[model samples]
Target chain A: MARIEINQSLCKGCALCTLLCPEELIKIGNQINENGYFYAVFTENGSCKGCALCAKICPDVAIEVWK
Target chain B: MSEKKIFSRPKTLKDAPFHFCPGCHHGIAHRMVAEAIDKYSLREKTIGVASVGCSVFLYDYFDVDVIEAPHGRAAAVATGVKRARKDKIVFSYQGDGDLASIGIAETVHTANRGENITIIFINNTVYGMTGGQLAPTTLLGQKTTTSPYGRDFMQDGYPIRMTEILATLEGTAFAARVAFTTPKNINMAKKAIEKAFQFQKEEMGFTFVEILSACPTNWGLNSIDSMKRVEEEMIPYFPLGIFKERKAADVL
Candidate 1:
C-alpha cells in the first residue's frame, strides 16, 4: 500500500528513522553501500503507513515514502 | 471585542505528521522561524534561501517564498536578492557545514560587505546533512566520522567559534550565539533572531545568529541526549550571548 525508498549511499545508519517509525518498517542492514556508510533499509514494507517519519528523522536526507 | 487565538500550526509545516524523530530540535527551530514570520507578517513578501546542510529544507520548513542554493552559498544568493529588492526582507537559513565549513568564505565576505540581510546559522558541531563528520565548530575532542577516535588539536585543528570570529569584523552589524537547549534558551534565541530581523528591517546592516542546534542522529545519541550534549559539552566550547552589537550604537 505504501512505498519507501532510501538513497543507500546517503543513508547514515543513524537508526533514528528505525527508532521513530511506529510501524517498525525500517532497519539498518549488515550490508555496506558504495559510500561505506551502513544504510537503513525498509524491512516491513507492509507496515509503513506512509507517515514520512523516516524522512523526518533521517539526518542525511536518505528516506522517502509514498502511498 | 476579543481576538481569537490561532491555535494551529503553519500551513507549510504539514500536519502533526513530522518526519523528524524524538527530541529533534529541527521541529522547534522550524516552529520558531514560522512564529517569527507570523510576528513580522513577512510570509508573503519575505524571501528565504535554504542552505545545503541539515536545515537544507528550511525553505520547506519556513512559510515564505523559498529558493534553494548550493552548499554554503545561501548568503551570497541572499546578498544578491537583498541588493536587488531592498523592500523585501531577505534571509538565509544555513547549517554548520553550509555556513562555517564550505561557505566560510561566502559568510565572511557577505558580513564584511554589510549586506542588508539576516542570517540564521544553525551550528550543531558536526556535518549533519551528510554524516557525523567533523565540522569547523565540532568540539576539540568530539568523535565524528572523520575523527573516529576524537578530535586532536595537533592534527584536527581548533573548533571555530563563529560568533567571536565575526564580531571583530567591522562589516558585521550584529552577531550573537543562542541555544535551544530549553524553553528559556529557546525564548532567548527567538528574541535574538527578532532583533536581528529588526536590524535588517531598519536597513541597519548584516545580522547573524549562531544557533546551537541539536543533531541527535549524527551525535549517535537520542534526541534528548543530543540536547544534553549541547548544554554540557558543546556550550563550553561555544559560549552564548551577543558577541557584537552595532545596532545598539546606531540607536544612539
Candidate 2:
C-alpha cells in the first residue's frame, strides 16, 4: 500500500500531477488552498500505486508519497 | 503500521512558501538543487550565489548561506566566494538574461578559468522578472514585450546555445541542458544536477546545468499550455543532452 500527502497550502493547482498520475487517483479539488488555488487531492481510495509520478512532477514540491 | 516517508521537503530548503508564479518551474529547480545539497551533506559548507531576475530570492529559499549578486555578475561573485573559502561548496543560480545576455562575458571567463563551482542556469526564453523581455535564449520568432513583432532572425539574430558554446571551452568539466516538463524529464534533470554538484565537490572544473523552465506568467499562457510549449516548441530548438563531460584523466 502507498500513502500520499499533499501540502495543500503550497500547491499551486497546476494539475500537472493530475495529468501525470498513472492511476488517475489525483485530481484538482474544488476547495481553494490558502494561496487561492484549487489544490490537487487524492480521489481514489487504495488505488495509489506509489509510482510517485505526481510527486516527481509537482513543481512546488507539494506532494509526498510513502510506500 | 507507521508508513515510512518516501518523499518530503528537502532539508536544504526552507519551510517558507515559494514566491514564484503559479506553474513556474523555479520551484522545481530549487527543490532539485536543495535535494542535491542534502544528498551530498553539503548543507553546512555550501554557499549559494543568487543572481538577478525571477530567481533573485534564491537565498531565501535555500537553507545554506547565500549572497546576492548583481544582475549577470553571479559568476564573478561566486568566483570570489569560492576563492575566499576553498573549503566551501559554491554554486550560482542564474536566469537566461543574467547569464547569457548581460553576464555572458563573466560566465565565459569564469568557465574558461576552470572555477570549481556549479552553475544552475534557468532558460525560460524570456526575461521572466522584468515583464517578459526578449532574452539571448529566446527562440526565433518568439514574441516578447520587447519583441512585439516577434523575434526576427534578421533583426534579433539567433538564440544563443550557451551550453553548446561552453562545451567547446577547455575549462568546462560538465555541461548539460535538461528540462523539467515531465516526470521522466524531472528525474533526468535531478540526476544531471546531482552529477554537476558531484563534480564541484570533487574540485573538478566548472559545471553547468541549464534547465529549460516554464514561465506561465511571462509567456501569457496557462500553466499546462506553458509546459506543453516547452516540449512542443522549446525542445526542438534547445535539444536536451550533455554537451560536455570531463573524465578523471581529462580533469588533470
DockQ scores of the candidates: 0.03, 0.79
Q: What is the C-alpha lDDT of each candidate?
A: 0.76, 0.92
Prediction 2 TM-score vs. true: 0.98
Question: Which 10 residues in a row give candidate 1 chain B its minimum summed lDDT?
Answer: B1-10
Q: Give per-residue CA lDDT, model 2, range A14-61, as digits (tens).
A: 888887888888888999977789988887588787888788788888
User: Model 2, stretches more than 4 Å misplaced?
Assistant: none
The DockQ value obtained for model 2 is 0.79
Q: How many angstroms is residue B160 displaced in model 1 relative to the true structure, after the best TM-score fit?
A: 0.2
True contacts kept of 1: 0.00
Name the regions of candidate 1 deviating beyond 4 angstroms. Answer: A1-67, B1-7, B10-18, B248-252
Best by lDDT: 2
Q: Residue A67's C-alpha lDDT in candidate 1?
A: 67
